[model samples]
Target: MATKTPKNPQKKHDGRRKNLIDNKNLKSPRTGIRKWVYRFFVAIIWFLILLVPVTIYYAHDLPDISEITQPKGGSTVMVMDRSGGLLASYGDVYGDWLEFDDIPAVLVQAVIATEDRRFFDHGGFDIRGFMRAMIKNITTGRMVEGGSTISQQLAKNLFLSADKTLKRKIQELLFSAWLEMNFSKEEILTYYFNRVYFGSGAYGIDAAARIFFGHNARELSLIEAAMLAGVLKGPALYSPLRDLERSYRRMGDVLDNMVEAGFIQKSVAEKTKAENVQIVDKQTGGDERYFSDWIVERAASLIGRVNEPVIIYTTLMPDIQDKANKALQRIMDQEALTHKASQAALVSLDMDGGVRAMVGGTDYTVSQYNRAAQAQRQPGSAFKLFIYLAAFERGLSPDDVMRDSPVILKGWQPKNYSGEYLGQVTLREAFVRSLNTVAVKLAERINRKNVIEMARRLGLTTPIVAE
Candidate 1:
């Protein structure tokens, strides 16, 4: 009876637990807290495990910054003017780089407003814009609207090729993520504004302003900035110096963008636009295209491959080339109208192998077939330099005697230009006079291979042969 004292006194229990650990599950008073800690650690690990895919997708979804932070300019191969002055170059022709601190806020605002209205608001990938682009691409069945921001453009310039594919987009996204992690927005914007092509062979905005407008980037007026910004679409197409009307219209579009983005007031935009941003006409008179063509060919030969464009350092006199160009233009203009399909090409290089004069074509814009060194047209009697060398190297001085006569070589017949068949003449007279018979006779005796070899050793770029 004493053992059966019913201790089921419905202990008026408070529903709220006094301890965080469940009392029923406690293995021991000592082990209770340890079990709770173990479960807490398990929950934390499960949460992290679930977040891993989200993190990976986020990383892949982010913009790639690897390209933008790279050294962008000065990789260009510069072709110096014959006087050792830097005339023209290819690749990124920038001596000075623009940094965040040096860049003007106005320029930054202009680019952000004109290029991407929501540049600052978005992560590297613009979600709203991307969705919009996706809709357009889906509906229109074409990749019409590209959702690339200023940062993405920098990435493309620095690391990616200009390929508009899904792979490029995915790669761009990953690279953009790296970029965001590495650089600040201002730094990204500075690189974007400084590295993007603005035309006239200018790689960066500073170079564009200086090259075209002849003003520092900081000194660029709103209208001038608009004109230079317009060149980003197509430098040659929107070049103010090349196409003033197109430039004005393009700049007007940029002004509209600036106004819409609230970077500039509408009234101010209209006033600036009306103030005549007429780009002054600029013509590079010392056109070194012949040398450019020559250098391109030479570079291809030296590198031994032509997969990508090669940059060449050349010794070309721009002024002299200009004079030669003008002179050749006059001569060709006069000659072309008089003769049908009658072409003339002149290449004058110095003894040290520097091109001093060149006339590639009458009009390169019309016909880009560079004739100076590209064409294989018979030099007619002009190629007599080879023959003179053939005779001279054989101990025949300028005043030596030579007999002009008919000769045959391996089924080919050789004869003098003179129908009178001049029998004997001095080597100098024959050389200066370009007599063919004696020159051919000397070539036959001197061995044609040795004669051609001498011509090659003295810097004949192209192959030569004596017949």
Candidate 2:
């Protein structure tokens, strides 16, 4: 009774004890919620104030809707051999412009399924898809999934660069919204198919079809469509010409996506996979491609900046190019390793000096340097051709004998290539044997200046210093 009386004294003194709730000091839940909401609305207002001017600044540069039908002042140069067959392409590839109705339904389905399954349902951005991608990227510790819809991709490709910046991303979103507002889904898809870049320097579905399958875009098979669709992720990484196995693997994934999206039956997907799609053989040309590249380099000078589609008729002979490529590759493959040579080049010209065939290197993909034209190597014994020609022109016959011994010219002793010298050899023997000592002796007899003059006259444009 005494303990209860002492504890209850303070409690009984006031109207309420300062226990769980103090009316004077405690905050009201209603008031707190109102304050938070007010701050949130104020923050939203500030965000709008900041976003409006930036949006206007970026949106001002957006291309007109009509301009999207074609690349802005861009065109492709179609390089062809003498037979009018496609050798290679240069500049911005436009390909054959395709309409929505002309494109294959399967190809469209493939693109939609693989790129954005909710393309028809979304406005411009896919919020749920973005959230999912965010979660997946965070959990996976890498960006394996992208939330960009087909509209977003089109917007980025058309209006903005591929730079991974916040400003670029905001511009992309705004442009995507603009694109969604301006065109129908079908029109967007048509623009996408006609403008997107595929691998092996191919742009647009038509170029992809022709380059990869050697067919028109309208004729893309089920497997072919899947492969083409897969290329949208990364053109070079998934290109059939770049990596066949990786390309097929991505193609299979696209097929699976198509089946899951109800665009194609599982059985059909399976059948397509089992049937094995036929990709264009990458080994069709080795050196002719170099010649094609050479033509491509000079094409702009020949035709000017390619702002429109142009067909360049080149001086390439496919058959001769193939032979030249094989010969160079054979020498590189058979003799290069044995002789410790890293590369080789071959240039075969027609009687009239038309570049019939040219091999830049053992593998054009590995090294694009055209040794026949671009390389500046000491010709070594090959320079002897000039000296011997000078000697021959100076009344020296092929049967004229020259001492095959080592000789010193101002402390520079020329040695034979074989490191051994014959006592006396004919001029023809020295020329055939590539005898360096004999070559130097012949150069001395021909008075070196004449040899350099003869080389200059024979189209040797490089500076020659007489030392």
In order of listing, the candidates' clash counts read: 9, 0
TM-score of each: 0.47, 0.54
For model 2, how does the per-residue alpha-carbon lDDT over 1-467 read when each residue is reduced to its tens digit? Answer: 45444666666656454443567677645577798998899999999999899899877776565668655456677888878899876566447888999899988999888788899999989998899889999999777889999999988776666667887888889988988998999989988898787855576899889888888898988889999999889774677865567788999999999989998899999888876767776553455666775676565434434356888897788898889878887788788878999888888888787888888778766444566766678877768889989999999999999989979999999787679989798999888998988888888887989999999988897768778
**Which parts of model 1 are misplaced by more than 4 Å?**
1-91, 133-145, 278-282, 285-467
The worst-scoring run of ten residues by lDDT in candidate 2 lies at 298-307
lDDT of each: 0.67, 0.81
State model 1's lDDT: 0.67
Candidate 1, residue 132: how far the Cα is off, in Å: 3.3
Give the distance in Å from residue 167's predicted Cα in candidate 1 to where it truly belongs: 2.7
Alpha-carbon shift of residue 447 in model 2 (angstroms):
63
Q: 71 in model 2: Cα distance from truth in Å? A: 6.6
In model 1, the Cα lDDT at residue 338 comes to 72
